[model samples]
Target chain A: MNALRNAALVAVVAVAIVLQAVVLRYVSVDGVVPNLALVLVVVVAVSRGSQFAAVFGFGAGLLLDLAPPADHVAGRWALALVVVGYLAGRVRQDARESPVASVLLVGAMSFVGTSVFALSGVLLQDGALPVDLTLRVLAISVLWDLMLAPFVVPPLLRLVDRLGSDEVAAARPVSLARTS
Target chain B: MRRRRFGQGPTHDGSRRVLGLLVLAALTVITLDARAGDGSPIDPARAAVGSLFGPVESTTAAVTRPFADAISSFRTNKSLRGDVATLAAENSRLRGEVSTDPLDRQRLAELDGLTRTAAETGYSLVGARVIAIGPVQSFTRSVTIDVGTSSGVTKNMTVLNNDGLVGRVVQATSSTATVLLIVDTESVVGARLGTNSEIGFLRGRGSIADSGRLDLELVDNAVVPSGGDVVVTWGSQNGVPYVAGIPIGRVESVVSSPRQSSRIAVIVPFVDFSALDVVGVVVPQGTTGDRPVISTPTGKADR
Candidate 1:
């Protein structure tokens, strides 16, 4: 059962990364690709807890870092997503189980995650991308992530709840029973 | 305040500890990867991931491409058809002019480049479909092409579309190649203005949010290119990365005050980067001992 769940998680991450790279890229608004992986981490964290979120974030980030044309110091994303996942998990523990609240949390976390990633790039001397450009991308990405959250996060939560992860079940009862 | 209390509770300490350890591990990986200086330790893992994921991405792209094309065609098909008809008429008229001026060296030189670049320069081009884009919010502009080392693609080879220079190949696995688009902030190309031939360098603005723009820096501050002047690649050592005479963009507007000692112009690139479908990788002809460098309009060797 554990092996099956792990395999399923890996499959989910792979599919999210692939869709982000292939489909979401072409459907970008002015070049800002919607970060499905960011939303996935946030959704999983909010659905589960810090332990599960942190572990999943690390796995997703490692896969993303290893992806070609990564163009930054490896593991910067892992560090950033670790913080994002933990923070979202904290929010999940405290906040009400409302879609609007979840959207707000996701948006806020997306901004923080993008900022941390950018900051790591700068500190690591990755490249000489201007500061203004980085901030603009962060802003657009936040808006895009929010716009996509309503569609992605709710459905994904529903799917995971149906898949019946014990960690997810103990953390929060399935509130998205009618999302699909 | 209630949330703050829960966050600080004894049970939460374990979560915090887990977070700390994860962050430490990530930082350690970053430090080791950076200091290692060659590449990451997980290169084999990376290659495996690429091999596995690349095909799935390509399949998805294939399935969605027709739908994307249909949507685009629905929006622009009428106007595009009209334009095509107009261009056809103009081409026939140009053909008459070319025949009449067959001996005109200037017209012939211009026509030579249009006929076949592979014939003109010894760089053979391998056509590839753009399968996926880099899925991050960072300044790295890269795309995955269906072709790879299996199709003779190599790292640092130039990629271009019909409009102009795209970028260079950064990584090529067996069945996939990753291209770093010229729009990447870190991308810099040696370029020159069309009208005055003033040499300069064109750098990518690096934001997909602000596409079709590059930062142009001139070597000579005294020479300012007029608005609408074309920018073309200035070529590099043996043109391994970038070849000569490929259109980069047009000057949209000039930045930097004339008196302040900086000449910077905003360039609108010719290629529609956001809608990239197919591209070509320029690989030098095998068995041909070094071809002569092509000359620019200003009578300077592009290399």
Candidate 2:
């Protein structure tokens, strides 16, 4: 049962990463696309414990980092998302986050996650990475991620809840009760 | 008051252990990939993963592209309709004057000018479709195009649409290439104003909202390009990066100070960088036939 659930999570993450790399790019505004993968990682982190979030984030991030058209050094996103997933997971699973609150959290996490990704590139002295560019990107990215949250997060949470009912119920009985 | 329970359940301790292991694994991967230098141990894994996902993405893109195109066309339809009306009116008026001597001379001169501009550039074009734009988090003003080495695309080639300059190729794989847009803060282009034929440097502000406008600076203190003056590339020696006579932008406003030797102007680029779709790359002239180069005429007074 655990193995099946884990496989489901991996499949979901894989599909999300592909959509992010390929599909969502078509709708970019001013070279800014919503960080769908980051939002998914955050949702998983907030609903599940840090442990599951961290592992899931690392896997998702690795796939993203390895994806084609990825210019930065490999594992940059993995490292960034791991930190994001862990931090998001630390916010007690049972605590109720209102819709606005969840959106705000996703927005903040997107900014922080992007910062970590850019900072890692900068630290590696990737000469192309500039501080001002990073800041500008962070600002626009946060808005894009926030805009996507209301649409993406609820559906994803519902799917996860439906697919892995036993674990989700064990993790947050209150959320299960509310949804049911 | 009810208390919040954190990390409860049967596998709590095991979860902590997994988290630690994951973190360590991520750190290790970052290190290994970074230090690998010219060759990466993980490139094959990445390539394999990319291959696995590529087909699905292509299929999805192929399936949904028409809807995306329809939406985009709908958004631009009104503006396009307005342009069509204006052009039709101008064409009718021009047709009425074809028999007049002065109008004939003026039209001939305009044709000559366009011919000279194209001849001066001496470029071979390769057309490509934009596949993906940069993610907002990367803050990189770039786009990936479907054509790459297979289509004779190489790094540093100038890219443009019908409107004007779009960007330059930064990286190229066998099947695709990434273009660094003119709006990227790091991009710098040598430009000449239409009014005085004065040359200057154009730099991007790198703002997502302000990307449509670039900063034109380094003009001689004595010559200030007026508002609406056209800007074009100065072209590099042998046209390695940018060819001469490609339209860039028009001056929006100018700023000057007596203390400084150079004047600054704001230019609104002709290309709509935000809405790029199909673009042409100015690749090297093929060896079979060399293009004839013509000297472009000097600047005319601003209208």
Highest TM-score model number: 1
**Model 2 spans with C-alpha error above 4 angstroms:** A1-11, A21-31, A62-76, A95-104, A115-140, A161-174, B5-57, B74-121, B192-200, B208-211, B219-226, B237-239, B256-262, B286-303
Q: Compared with the true structure, what per-residue lDDT tens digits does model 1 show for residues B1-303?
A: 242543544447788889999999899888977777655675666677777777787898889664444333333334532132343345445443433332235335433443255454455667677888885485578889987776667778888776778899877777788888888877889998988889898888675543558989999988877899999988888776888877888999888875878889889998878767657777665421122332223333323
Q: Where does the lowest 10-residue lDDT sum fall in candidate 2 chain A? A: A92-101
Candidate 1 TM-score over all chains jointly: 0.81
Q: What does candidate 2's lDDT look like per residue over B1-303, in tens digits?
A: 566666566757877787778878987887887899656787677657655654455566667564444334343434532132343344444444434454346445544544444345555566566766666565456667776666677678888766778788866665667677887666789888876788989987664444467889955767868889999988898676777788998888887766875688989998777666667777664411122222223422111
What is the C-alpha DockQ of each candidate?
A: 0.41, 0.32
Could you tell me every candidate's TM-score relative to the true structure?
0.81, 0.70
**How many backbone clashes does every candidate have?**
0, 0
lDDT tens per residue, model 2, A90-118: 76343234566667778888988988887
TM-scores of chain A across candidates: 0.90, 0.89
Give the TM-score of chain B in candidate 1: 0.73
Quote the positional error of residue B140 for candidate 2 in Å: 0.8
